[model samples]
Target chain A: MSKGVAITGMGIISAIGNNVAENYQSLIDGKKGITRVEKIDTIHKDVIMVGEIDITNEAFEKKLGLAKDNNYSRTAFLGAVAAKQAIADAGITNINKYKTGLISATSVGGMDRTETHYYNYLTEAEPRKYIDGHHAGDSSQKIAEQLGIEKSLVTTISTACSSAANAIMFGARLIKSGQLDRVVVGGTDCMSKFTINGFKTLMILSDTYNTPFDENRKGLNLGEAAAFLVLESDAVVKAENKTVLAYVKGYANANDAHHQTASSDHGDGATLAMEKALKVAGLEPKDIDYINAHGTATGNNDLSEGRAIIRVFGDNVPDFSSTKAYTGHTLAAAGGIEAVYSVLALQNNIIYPNLNFKTQMKEFNITPQLTLKEKHLDVIMSNSFGFGGNCSTVIFSKEA
Target chain B: MKKVYINSVCAITPQKTFDNTQFLEELIEYDANVINVVNPVYKDFIPPAAARRMAKGIKMGVVASKLALKESGLENVDAIITGTGMGCVRDSEKFVSAIIDNDEQFLTPTAFIQSTHNTVGGQIALELGCKGYNFTYVHSGISFESALLDAKMQLELDEAKAILVGGVDELGDHTVAIHKLVNHIKSENINSNALLESKTQGCVFGEGAGFFVLKNEKQESSYAEVVALNTYNTLDEESVNEEAIRFLEENNIEASSIDAIILGNNGDVNFDGYYNKLTSKTFKDIQQIYYKHISGEFNTASSFGLWLGARIIKSQILPEAVKLNITETSKFKTILLYNQYRGKNHSFTILKQC
Candidate 1:
């Protein structure tokens, strides 16, 4: 069998926690982060609850030591912080010692800044500095600059909600194919009036705490976050004698080719992605110890994803759950944050309960894990489905 | 590594290249910095309902993908990968400006739904019902090359048999006005034919979609084989020559093996030096060509360069309109392409006659 890509370190800054430790603590303690909007002034404040990070731009700038004249958007600032923490956790003293690359994903990019200066650009000059930072690559470039990973392959992926999953898959392949010895793979997205209103237009913003796999689930709550994981090849791991957190055993990306915003009735894309991922890992349906589902608590996602899970696992479905109730749907960063959670579950021999899964779905007989369960686990599968029928699955294992 | 072949290409640029019968036979001239794509009959390809809510970028991507698939004689592909710098910017601008313009009330979701960077790629997959690997790259100039690299790697590994890879970007109203303010767009009107000669500080902005079907095996329509691909997030001016040498060397091909060089010269005086560095130093005697003057410059405009490379190899005829120098070549094979945007995201891709 082929050796799997080894995950050395992981870092994340989501609404639930500022780093991996806080996130793990919250998960074990069942401390939810969903709340009413506090930072951004929006009229829908009454109707929407978000997994908003309780940090201000000024505070972030001060922490990152960003110059006042710096044009770092909320997205870039968060990404740099998470990426830097990942490097430190990995104990990588010389970033350029090995062939290194960074593949950062983002859906919001610099919209946090662009929307603020959109109209002002036509009349004001001070706001014009952000004009160049509006593209999706800008945030990735800033993160790359912050990490000092220059003259290497650095790119950004924006496949809606599954963007970070694809980034991890790409980084794993890069190491597997000997394109690079080590890589930093993750995603970053910050809440913006643009996305808030965008989700509002779709009418998918949940009014209260999200309930996943429930019959009366209303919609998803939008969240903002950034997460990163350092993936190193076996050669690099052996040379550095690094401690491996987990192994990315298998990964796959398949489009539903179904609808633009809605999933297919049976979750064809999700089924294909999971089936293919199992095949890549040389495992069967019975091998997945737990599943971190992409249950956004939306009406369509839960039903479709539930149906897909049933289609794949038939009578004996694994102990599956979604952490979206804890952090809302972080869009592009969902896969990254969840990957960290999956690894934590493996390391700690625990399964964080899928919070807020009260009632069973009417369509499917499968039920998600509703209580915190302590079971020795060997493998976990993470599923992330986004708009455009994009479905991706990554399997993590404690063994190499 | 297994070889990947470019089986089919469809481009909807400012030129009249959409029709297979003509290959830039008549160059369309434009005197404005911001030029829109030569419109395709969207109704012919899309339905009324889908086309009604579709943004210009989505329309171009769907039509271009359809045309490429049709020409390749494939009903559906195993994967759909697309690249766009600012996806559906017109919708982004509309949705954003409306948020401010309307005080964020009573705004519908159509514009916002279509504003994502992956909208074009997602819509293409939905149209064909291709439930395979789908990805979208949104890096500025190398966006197209990133898509190409991903497709090429998959083909080499036999991950997917046939894949549809494309680059699509559309012009937005407010985006154009703001770019003008930043001097990213040229100030004075310059004819498309005289783009490079103007020696302007900024490029002539343009928008279009280019799609190609790549396969692991060669077919009757196979024009060129993907030889090598390389991208750099940053490449200083002096190291460009060494970089080109190392890229060709890694592929075990010498500079003399390069029959023609496809240059992405958008007439930007400052960054064109990267291209000029090669022309004056190593590839001076080789046949050189450029296409941004005709296709106009966009983030993924390098796709147009790939389209032109395939056509040159298959037709064995170079249109005089895109020729940079008078040096003639006896044969056309092993074409090298180099592209950069304002001295960032440099890419080098090579193609060989199949």
Candidate 2:
């Protein structure tokens, strides 16, 4: 693979854990964060399972050291916390030393606040502070402010589930084009009644644990999370002597163009994305060491993605698994958190088990990794497909 | 580096710009704080089955994209990128209200599905069956510029030959009411032509969509070449000009070379000074033009500014209505467009006549 953008650091806060180390420990211990929703008040709370973080909005605000009158939404707070952790992990003392940028992805934005005060904003005065925070970019703006990144190219992408993956891709392109020396790219999304009810209408929220690559798989559990990675150029990495976590070797995005919300029956978009990613990385399917599948466990996604994987790898499929059972489907942050997991996989040479799988999928002969296994993993490919038929595949390698 | 060309441009704004041949010859004047697009009979481009489910934003975006594709004479593009400030606000409003009013019961998936910010980009891709790179940006005022920058980079890198880029935002009743409460919408109605003179604190909020086919290789229909584009998330009064001049310098162009300037003057007295700074100093001698009075101010209103720049360069005519300054230039080679929202998310785009 070409000398790719170096991922100097990564940080994540999800239902499974609040930090990278905790998340890795959860993965090895086979601990799932799926449980009944405790934070949001929704009618479907009893019928659905979710990967909700145990922290409250007040706690997140306190953690970020923001004033009580601050307009930091749950999404922004989560994004700021994760981004700060990433900068620290990269061991950067000064943010303005280099031409740095921030690319954040979030579908929810401040909708958590919006939904809570939807009607109250019209009648009450206290909740009116969130009126300006309703858009998808507000959270991104807050993230940039928290990172102390001003006069920079800070933007947000809202491609639903694959948002963070696209953010990472855009950041990588910026680095390749010499637009910026360092970039903080990732996605953040907080669970909201808007999304909970929206997905409830789609009838895709599982009542029990999600089972990926299983014949009896029902649907997915909604999740809330924020994950960010600090990508620095080779010159910056060498100059700063940053400890590289992994390298973004290849990335590609393709539209399914088959459905507004569902993937193609044949996973044509997913296949094309993977193919283009491999071509971009100048690697073949055999070069892949692990596949972090976008297996939402939804009947449509798993089936379509499975067929697409088969078409890409044919008979020599890599050990693949989906961590959704542990963290649920974190909408836009799915790709970002999955990327952290992919890096961890490459760093530790360990494959995480796909929990809740009891039966083999009849549509394809391939199955997910069922147990935690230590193996030599040099390259990992992570997939993230979202609403709007946005499909993305990002490859992470141990060596740049 | 490959030069990216604006091969074709189309817009469905408050004015009669949808018909490319008519260069805003007759403006549809409006006297309202919340203006809407002069509706295009979407049935001409979209079937009833599809149009029935679409919100105004989706319909405008789809039809505008179809017109762009028709003008470019291309069956499909290598990529489709869209930018929307509010996504499908009508649908979002509907879905959100449904959850509250109906107690989160009996809600269907149509509105929620269409509420995603990327719905327009995805719909265009589905229509063209263009499964190449698809991206959606939703960063307030610079949303459209972000998409343009992304497409320009891809074309510059020869990663894609032709890319469909668009920006769309539809006003929602609830959203409008809320904005009015926040003083984001003007309190009093005023003539469209008198927007800048209104001395209002808020803008005449509007909704519209603009789409263009950008290609790496210049074609017969190419309007102008995209020279350079940059966006800043935050900029104070002290650094706005420095950043803009620095951006121009990086493009190896001097301020004197710019023949015409397009400024996003949305009539918000507080923020309009950002443009005035350039008008009073940096670009005092150049021909100045603006179209927010005609297009109305939306998050992606700058897309209309882009469309205006392309039209001015291609036709080499400064429309009397859009002219902000009396000075005239013999050449309309390079047009610089700058836009920002509430003094944030600033974008500067330079387009040269090809």
Candidate 3:
């Protein structure tokens, strides 16, 4: 309990880029990944934009060298790709060395396959392999198998958009509790007609670009992505002489219980989560130098989260921005992807801009950091909220 | 750290165990490949207006949780956590099929909102108006175990006094069809009695919800103490015995001291060996119990085993139906529960009489 969890490595594949380095470059260059759907055969491609990855499922499968009979779903494919990268980035060739575990998160697990063959499963036997990958946990199990992580705590968390953050939180707790020496924590989610229409029904899908905390914001652009962080216990780090990338200083998850999809006007849950995270880190809000706001750009999230931020920081809020404009709302993968971005911000001492923000939100006098700026950052606070009133906050610090 | 205890448990399985007042005295003999829970009058626990919008998983979870809380004599918990592998599948299927059918047009928010994997936890929070630590784990067979672990940690850390935790999954046409195609669900109907010997590729698929109120302090309602729980992503059949021993040893217990062992024998021939390795060899002398035959099988079905273990500790009675062999013990003080699905996500849970 005394030794803190160390994040030794991180990997990410988002609409903005394919790897951590590419994503960092894209962020520094202010490149956004917003575009209309080109790969999936959806009629809403023209009306709804997405943060879709450039690679196709076939190419992704090729990267993993899967046999034709392999029942890897798109979600599993994305997850394996990112998880392997994280493992490699950690410089650990033998993943099974330490008492390692993998904790992945996903809201849509092999759902793309399920949706594609929903009606045709009876008529088509070719896609039958995908039938077993339909559960929310299947993709994670696949990722673990792909990583050769056997006989470990391989699991998934599907707390909607905040899922990946919760996964990271749980992984940190596991490491802290001495349950596992090292754990790969992150989330993966591929674009699906299910989530696209699901968000559309809520009237929260932005047609063009998302403007977080804007006066007249439309909504978010859903994205497909996978990101993972390799968190190792202090003893493992000491034994392996691991290169520490950053530290998962604190994390907290709280429920609003106000509404299923809506947050309270005052952001009660968000406030409690942020406050608890700060308490966990034994740091005050003033210690945070940067904040990666959840900023889904939805009418509900931005307002609720903004109020929560204001409540925590008061007059001297830290330099903050929402990177969601770069990679639309990745739902379950948001927390993991943002975690990568948070670590990157800490390493590079740069605050990524909140792309597409034009005006200050009227509900509260809070304006986001619109330009990428060079600043010395010590701790970065990231927030993620989801349906079912799930809210989570994780703080990444340069020093433990 | 204070010991975590299972204050009360309420299960909505294929059997009638919702009230916490009865055991499996009368079981519903279902002849279908998929078994649905013997539902209680949900209106007695949840409002119809609220119940109408909930998916079966959410409704069952909420109702079962309310029953557990009521039985435990608590109005609200410090936190609410739930585990579901598919999570609101009816709503997920509805939303997905609607998107494909309408070309992503005319979609309503109801199905979409309920489609999240954590909808049950969120809905429970809303119903109880409990603004506290909330989490939902969707980790397949370990989903319930993950929730239990989280609750245990919170109780040990004194962050929460009482936490409402549960594992729930519901039946849906698309899920069933897909599972059947993948052979995770039995392709053909098999007798429950012959489940373990059917030499089948898949187990009997079922839907159920099991909820428990875990408290840091022991009380009159407390059934048993959660001594320890451990989960593994993948374990060879050869390691089951060692793993069980190591788990008990870590908890400062011995294999011989375990009063009874509850195994998750879902009857999937391909995976049931993980249990057979222990029940048939390592703990051969310990009284063995199983429930999937009666509850059917689901990802979170292990929670039903926990519910049963708690009940056995409290009532000190093992229904003749759940017994694996004619072995009895004078006192039921400690129970060990081991569960896995398709030979992955193995878990060992130890519960002790309060």
Candidate 4:
């Protein structure tokens, strides 16, 4: 068997918490971070809910120690903060000591600033500073600058919700292919008026608490977050004798080719992705002890993904749950955050409850694990499906 | 290790490049700061119902990919990977403006759905009904290079047999206006032929799509063999030449062996120095070619350079319109392409005749 990519450290900033420890604490304590909108001024604030980070832009700027005229957007702020924490968590004193690269993923990017300054840019000069920061890659560039990673392969992916999953997959391939020794891979997205109104228009923004795998489930609750993981090659791990958090054993990206915004009814793409990932990991369906589903609490996603699970795992399905109840659907960052949770699950031998799940859907006989459970886990599978029929599955293991 | 070959290539740019039957035999000159692509007949590639809802970027990408697949003689590919710097900015602008104008009331999902960066790739996959690997890279200038690297690695590993890779970007009025405000778009309109001589602060903004079918095995219609590709987030003016030498050395190539080099010179007086440094010193004797004068400048404009390089290697004909210097090479065997936006996202790509 081939040696797997080693994940040495991880960092996360979400509605549930600001750091890895806090997020772990909230997950174990059954704390939910979903609440009514507080940061953004939108007309639907009363009718819609979100998982917004409590910190403000000024607070983030202050924490990062930026100049008064710094043009870093919320996406950049969150990405840099999380990536820096990941670098420190890995206990690397010199970022450039080993050949390292940063692959960040984002959907909103600097849209928050763009939407705010769209009109102002025409008449004023101050907001024009942010104009350069509007593209999807700007946040990644800023994050790289903050991490002190220069003259390295730095890129950004934006496959909607499956972006971070793809980033991790690509990072693993880079390591496996001997392209780089160390790579920091994850995704970041901040709450923005553009996305808020975008989802609102799609009619997928749940007004109440999102309930995944429930017959009465509404749509998803939008959230903003950033999460990152530091992946090192076997050579680097051996040289440094690092603490391997987990092994990124398998990953696959598949297109449903069914719809633009919705998933296939039978989840063909999700099934293909899970099967291919398992094949890559050289594991059988029974080998997976737990499954962290891409249960966005949306009506279409849960059904399609649940059916896909049934198609792949068949009669003998493993215990599965969705953590969106805790942090909501974080869009592009969902996969990264969920990967962190999967690692935490493998480390602690715990299974987080699918929060807010009430009634089991009639479409499938299987139901999500509604409460926290402890078990001896060896392998965990995480699924993240997105618009444009993008389906991704990443398998994590305790052993290389 | 398996060898990756460019089976077929297609491009739709500001110039009349979509036909592929001709290669810069006729040139269209413009005297504007911003240019739009010379569009192909949408009905020829996409159905009327679908084309009506599609935006310019999506249409261009879909048509270019279709043509590329046709040239490769494949009904579908194993995967689709796309790169875009701004994505469908027009739809994004439309959605955002509607939200602001309507105060988050009575908004439709069409524009919002199409604004995603992967919509082009997703659309291509859907059209082909190919449920395979798909990805989208959104880094500024290296977006297309990132995609190319991913496909190259997969092909080298024999993980995938055939992958469709492309880069596309479209201009939106609001995007252009804001860019002009920041001087990313030239302040004054200049003739296309005078782009380099104008010595302006910013480049003439343009948009287009370029797609290629990459396979693990060489084909009868192969254009070129992708030798090596690398990208850097930052490279100073002084270090660019040194980095170029190091890159060639890493690939077991010598600077003297290179027959031609494609440089991304967008007529920006400030950033074009990145290319000028090579033209004057390191690669002074090599045949130099520049295309942004005709294709205009976009984030993925380097894809045009790649298209030109692959065509030259296959056809062994260097168009006069793209020649930067009078230096001529009798045989087009090995070509190197260097591109960057502003001063960041530097890339070096080497292509060889198969």
lDDT of each: 0.91, 0.92, 0.89, 0.94
Residue by residue across B279-306, what tens digits does model 4's lDDT show?
9888999999999989889988999999
The DockQ of each candidate is 0.82, 0.86, 0.79, 0.91
Q: How much DockQ does model 1 earn?
A: 0.82
* Model 3 fnat value: 0.87
In terms of lDDT, the poorest run of 10 residues in model 4 chain A is: A1-10
In angstroms, how far off is A317's CA in candidate 4?
0.7
Task: For every candidate, give the share of true A-B contacts it also has.
Answer: 0.77, 0.81, 0.87, 0.87
Candidate 3 lDDT by residue in tens digits, A1-400 = 1234799988899999999999999999999999999888887788888999999988987899988788887889889999999999999998888888888999988889888888888778887877778888889888888888887788888888999999999999988877888999999999988888788777889898998889889999999999999999888888988899999999999888888888999899999999999999989989999999999999889999999999999998998899999999998999999999999999999999998988888888878999989999999999999888888999998898
- Sort all candidates by DockQ, best to worst: 4, 2, 1, 3
Judging by TM-score, tell me the better candidate of 1 and 2.
2
What is candidate 2's lDDT per residue for B109-210, written digit by digit as tens? Answer: 999999998999888888888899999999999899889999999999999999999999999998998888887889999798899998878898998999
TM agreement with the true structure for every prediction? 0.98, 0.99, 0.98, 1.00
Docking class of 3: medium
- Pitting candidate 1 against candidate 2, the one with the higher DockQ is 2
lDDT of 2 by residue, A1-400 (tens): 4668999988899998999999999999999999998999998888999999999988988888889899888999889999999999999888989999999999998888888888888898887889999999999999888888988899999999999999999999999999899999999999999998888889998999999889999899999999999999999999988889999999999999999999989999999999999998989999998999999999999999999999999999999999999999999999999999999999999999999999998888999999999999998999999988999999999988
1 versus 2: better lDDT goes to? 2
Question: Which residue runs does candidate 3 get wrong by more than 4 Å?
Answer: A1-4
Candidate 1 structure lDDT: 0.91
Assess the local accuracy of residue A366 in candidate 1 as a C-alpha lDDT between 0 and 100.
86
Provide interface RMSD per model, one decimal: 0.8, 0.7, 1.3, 0.6
**Clashing residue pairs in candidate 1 (N, C-alpha, C atoms within 3 angstroms):** none
Q: How far is candidate 4 from the true structure (C-alpha RMSD, Å)?
A: 0.7
Q: Against the true chain A, what TM-score does chain A of candidate 4 give? A: 0.99
As a TM-score, model 2 comes out at 0.99
